[model samples]
Target: MLTYYMPPKTMWSNLSKETLRIYLDQAQQAYNDLLIGNKPISVSYSQETGAKSVTYTQANLQQLQGYILELQRTLGINRRRAMRIRFR
Candidate 1:
């Protein structure tokens, strides 16, 4: 089975932008999979001295979303909708 690694959030700024982009892509793909009824998504990440695997469930959907947003923000690629209002 192929596995993807998620770098620690604290290390995001230090990672090369290319690496960060790869991570962001992985995160977004996982999030999309979960949204379409995929369950128990697995992601690996380094913790302390070793790598650990985390399984994300439907219950953790929001948390996954937060990760996506955080990554997007870090990459400065988050899409923000602009609104305009006019009153006469």
Candidate 2:
């Protein structure tokens, strides 16, 4: 059953289903963190060049958030379940 959601044209669009799922989870987590006014998201990378090892960090808060929103919009994830509460 095909729903109305389609993947957009992005760098991560071609990822495997499992990889995409992992990224989606991470993106949602980062979005929630940002909403709660927490620290910026960071991704670390280490490179080796024969006799040299360099380590650096990439601050990816905005990018991750943008991708998350884009994914949500393109994938029709904007729907929220209705909730009802009653106290007597």
TM-score of each: 0.67, 0.45
Clashes of each: 0, 0
Best model per TM-score: 1
lDDT of candidate 2 over 1-88, digit per residue (tens): 8655455565445545565555567667666776677766542222232232222113655566667676665454674546989999
Clashes of 1: 0
Off by over 4 Å in 2: 1-9, 43-63, 72-88
The lDDT, on a scale of 0 to 1, for candidate 1 is: 0.74
Residue 9 lDDT in model 1? 57
**Decoy 1 TM-score against native:** 0.67
Q: What TM-score does structure 2 among the candidates reach?
A: 0.45
What local distance difference test score does each model get?
Answer: 0.74, 0.54
